[model samples]
Target: MKTTSTDESSAGGVTPVAPDAATLESEKESMLRQPVAVWATALACVFAFMGIGLVDPILPAIAENLDAGPSQVSLLFTSYFAVTAVMMLVTGAVSSRVGGKRTLLTGLTLIVIFAALAGTSGSVGELVAFRAGWGLGNALFVATALAVIVAVASGGRAVAIILYEAALGLGMACGPLVGAVLGDLNWRGPFFGTAVLMLIALLVLVVKLPSTPVTGERTSFAAPLRALRHGGLFGVSFSALFYNFGFFTVLAYTPFLLDSGEYGIGLVFFGWGSALAVFSVFIAPVFQNRVGAANTTMLTLCGLVAVYVLLGVFHGTPWVVTVLVVVSGALLGVNNTMYTEMAMSVSDNPQPVASAAYNFVRWMGGVIAPFASTELAEKFDPSVPYFTAAAAAVVAVTVMLFTRSAVEVHGPHAV
Candidate 1:
């Protein structure tokens, strides 16, 4: 009897190992079941985004306690967003040289340092300056976070983008609730809490995230600016600039309108953030698949315009204002998801370069609108800020309509 050491077929040929059914099932797992690195990065993303709305619940508290005016307290957002906007121009340059993972860590470290410092601020000016530092950290992380997620996530780009937006929504939703809880104890608590949460995220990322290899390619500081030559990218970025004016008006100015105290304002915006999260994750894809990305963006921008108009009309009625704020979150979600997809896909420029370019432009709205809205409200009335935002929204819609052809993707182009 001749016994073969190797497992051979009856014909004396080696039998290949067949993958098990379980192995195939694992291979086909859904987007929810991602790798450790993806989850770690996404978790960090949630914490990072929380910083956006963290101050909303405490805006009134800060203004009252610090003995500062609405416009002065509003500078918190002004300084933060202004720094964030400027930093976007160089994120690609930094990340390309040091690599994505290190860049993320560096950003996280800055946030930890700045958030703690912000907690100890004795005046609005000090707080605003520290918040600017936080924005610097946020820009580095925010610019790199999407790229890391896209690079590591399974399924596809659509799934990855959705995940990133979901993180944004969750962070936004939770930010106010957390701020209310902590800020009620002391206005400084939220800042310290943010520092702790970010520190945890930083440590988790260091362990779970694998190193990203340096490609030895350095993006110039002007690379993001040069990316704007693409008609599609430029169209998306320009329209987003005006669109954000309306969006930030809603976010930064509405707290004073609510005047509901810390907990009440927190709950209201929590509901708003929840709406944003739900629509961006569940509803945005449905609309995009039905109407196409550019069309969806325009439709949502129109919806935002109507919302702003209603806000202007009902500024005196707190109930109506609250309801409008929640509803606007839904429209904002759709627009945000569509705008991001278009910016990433619209041009052949590298994803980092495109994001840096797109953000550099769009964030200008965030920089201007917060203080601008407060100043408008001070000079005229609360309704005037909403009206100003409505006009900006109208301009946004017109710009998109004119540039629709440049940004149209696989969807129908009726807009």
Candidate 2:
């Protein structure tokens, strides 16, 4: 028997967690079984992501209901991503400390409560303020949920990523339907429904999830930033930011551009979300196991650039646009999964700072994407945003070309 050394004095004398055979075996099985915790965490991720899309089609209606302008309505999106941007580092660190399950529960609770408040707000200021608070909850949940899957899942990092991201795709696939159906009743209905989903997931998580050993201790203030400077972390982080920026810019308005009423919602999400779903399950593994992360990213980047450009030039045909979007979506999922696995694998140290930096970089794109799209629509052709995404994807591929030397096995026992 490998007797693990126990250090009870660490972590504020919170009983030091021993990664024993029994615990490891249990974790190993739980992961394989797709136990409640795995599903719970995935469900939570689905809900969080759905929040991003749910408000999109309804923003105009919401603005009218609240007597707000387009600019003011935009805050609903901005405030959400903004808080998520600022708080991700802290959220990752705190989850590592207290435990992933605990932090997620609290965060989801806040989102439910605050989201309801924002949904009912009578004034633009109130709605924006509460939405920012809602964003705080989203930040905590989204950042840590992935980390939790990575931490506790015993089916290897690839499996963890696949399962978690699969749920995310399912959540996203369902969001527009939920919004379309619920929005017809009232603007607040989706928010309230989301709250119910979160509550149910919280219960499932508490019952099934094991406690995660603290993954990192707070360092002297400067060490985190310094750790992030190593192993091309900065490049990866920025790419994460730009990745989202590029994707969302295209996604936010693609329906307006290509949605000719013939395909309706099913084909739209089926093309976009279903591609992600299929890849997360069937295709993501090819990148990690066979193609290799950086090489896969390069391939995906080329596909994204090509598809966007194709959409720009040939979107008059609905089939052409659908195929292009589906290809883009499939490639996007691969790019994200492989890039994330690569980034985490790059550093030997615990990943809190690295994770934060990565998320911060990605959210920068989310922040910029909408503005870029809106501005391009104002000044250039609407197709400009699609072309801009194509250009950004090209830039990412170029960056990867330079940074390939930095890729290596990130964990000692990595598969």
lDDT (CA) for every model shown? 0.86, 0.67
lDDT for residue 21 in candidate 1, whole number 0-100: 56
> Model 2 compared with the native: what TM-score?
0.83
lDDT value for model 1: 0.86
lDDT of 2 at 360: 63
Estimate, for each residue in 97-151, the C-alpha lDDT of model 1 and write its tens digit: 9999999999999999999999999999899999999999999999999988988
Q: Write the per-residue lDDT of candidate 2 for residues 1-415, one digit (tens) a residue.
A: 0111235222212211324457545544645676566777887788877777666546656757888655456666667788888787587567756777778888888888887787677888887798889888888787778877766665545567667777777776677667656766787777777777777777777778787766556433343466667756666666666567667865565655554432253356555776777776567654554555667777877888888888778756777776777777787777766767666656644555566667766776776676567567657786787888888888888877776666633321221
- RMSD values, in order shown: 9.2, 6.5
**Model 1 ranges off by over 4 Å:** 1-29, 409-415
